[model samples]
Target: MAELTGRIALVTGGGRGIGRSVALSLASAGADVAVTARSPKELDETAAAIRALGRRAEAIVCDVSERTQVDAMVARVKTALGDPLILVNNAGIAASAKLTDTTDEMWDRMLRVNASGAFYCTRAVLPLMLAAKWGRIVNMASVAGRAGAPYIAAYTASKHALLGLTRAVAAEVASRGITVNAVCPGYVDTEMTDASAANIVKRTGRTEEDARKILEGFSPQGRLMTAPEVAAMTTYLCSDVARGINGQGIVLDGGALQS
Candidate 1:
């Protein structure tokens, strides 16, 4: 039997990028999946892809930053796919700006989606996991969570907060058959990174290739990591074999940010 044949997974930001990859990966591993994002079309596409893999799927339109939406999303997941024993908190936004230019709105937005969104979803699902005495939670963090970099102070701080949440929740549930962890990846080859590169081109007057190369250079691998690579790691963490691995941030930046 497949490792997660009886599991139900909920992936936030599952419309595209890493979230979509992780959702599909879990489905491939035999978990019925529920995908949530603000974009209904994208969410529907992702859900259809999961169904094509022969797993049950649900597409939920939700803005994770809002507590009401998060609560409703979880309710819908439970009604549709049973309790989500596996939760991938992958919804997030990224922006780069000098400290002086980072507005209060930007800071609040980062924290709300990247950190509090995870909190609300986790809280909503904890009861089910505790009742079952088995759960897996993977937070899609970044290298910024471990170390600070210039020009992304707000984003960095929000990620750090996420890591803090991961570790604390993991500790709280260590003896309860639930695991909470974070996957800290460097620049991923996604639309988000493309936007970052575009921003660089607009701000620094560099060619798009040069802007992308700058991001790729952050890792020793000299390339942007693929979404599947991150998805593979996330899928493993949600499996039974990974039960012992809890409360840790697994970094996948090709030898960068060693910690």
Candidate 2:
């Protein structure tokens, strides 16, 4: 039996990487999926993949950092797939800079996209969850959120804020049958990580392989984390078996940061 049978799930950034993996996994588990992203083309591709899995799917164009867009996206999802019982706040952006070199614009953008975006999406979906008396919210956080990284202060701070939001909202809805949690992965092999590697190469004048090695070495296992690995964790969190795991930040970093 599928764990998510009859569930409706909404995944932000569902166009690619971890978001795409999570959306497909949920559909495989029998949940109808609604996908949102800034790119309509990517959203359509993800929607098509979900439908290919024998599930209903809808694509919505949205930038989760914008409150109005978030609201409209949620409304569309509710109308198309019914109220989303599972929400994965998977949209985020990251950049690296020394604390003294981080620009005001970079700081603001990180917080706006990574933290505020999750806040807007969560706020938009909570009402429906409360009314139904059941919901699961999983924020895509990072190991940087748990531990400080020297060059990416803004990204780290935003992820930390996301974790804080997850805990606060989880507590508020604990009695309402809604669970809010976060998945913190370290150095996942995604487009974001690829960009980070390229950035490192540009900054340090190192070979791309060398820059990638730095990331892979972050995990004790000496390998980069895969999107499917993170998606699996997110998928489990949305299931009945994970009801007791609320208000937590589950780490999937190959035991990199033992907190």
Candidate 3:
């Protein structure tokens, strides 16, 4: 067991991808985790994985974009399990689109889920964290946030906003024993990247293999980061060893974004 023994953690978007990996990583470190996602079925899988690690899991169904639902989610988490000492605001959405082609719905959806959702979840959790005098918040950002991608205008803006929020909150809560940070990953081997790569293949009329190579070229390592690799950083940030690591946007881009 790692240093997170007995700690309670809540991970939004815990059903799949990096979020699911982060949840399991926390459990492996001896934390009791609450996994939240829009689908109960998916959340159940994450919970089952946690249970397999001999850790308790609170499976929660939540759509972080809705404020009312977010409030209810916080209440429910506290009610069913306990106050979460660590929060991973990993819920997000991205669209590959030009600014001119972006619709109001697309832009708003990106912002609501990627940026505003983090705000709401953080707001809901901060009071309790302050009262208890300890907390760790990790927001998932992307390489698009740091550099201008050709498309994905809305997604880029939203992730940039999320990174800003992460820094601001970390500064505000520094004296409260709370560390707020953002993890910005470059091309990750997740569903989102799969979709992006597929789109590139279609647009360029190139083979999927070639398109994947082009995407992978964005990383200096010429490869995608694994969810478990990113999860390791997240779990570390929540541990006692990372008390001084605050307000930083930790990029997992395989040297794509030097920071």
Considering every candidate listed, which one attains the maximal TM-score? 1
- Positional deviation of 83 in candidate 2, in angstroms? 0.5
Error of 1 at 68 (Å): 1.2
Local distance difference test, candidate 1:
0.95
User: By lDDT, is 1 or 3 better?
Assistant: 1
Candidate 3 C-alpha lDDT tens digits along 35-151: 888989989999999999999998988889999998988888888778988999999887787779999999999999999999999999999999999999999998777888777
Rate residue 2 of model 3 by lDDT: 46
lDDT of 3 at 131: 94
Candidate 1: pairs in clash: none
Clash count, one per candidate: 0, 0, 1
Candidate 2 segments whose C-alpha is farther than 4 A from its true place: none
Name the candidate, 1 or 2, with the larger TM-score value: 1
In candidate 3 the C-alpha lDDT for residue 197 amounts to 86
Candidate 1 regions off by >4 Å? none
- lDDT agreement with native, every candidate: 0.95, 0.93, 0.91
Task: Give candidate 3's whole-model lDDT.
Answer: 0.91
| TM-scores of the models, in the order given | 0.98, 0.98, 0.97
Writing each residue's lDDT as its tens digit, candidate 2 over 1-259 gives: 2399999999999999999999999999999999999998898999999999999999999988899999999999989989998999999998888899999999999999999999999999899899999999999999877989788899999999999999999999999998999999999899999999999899899999999999899999999999998888999999989899999999998987887
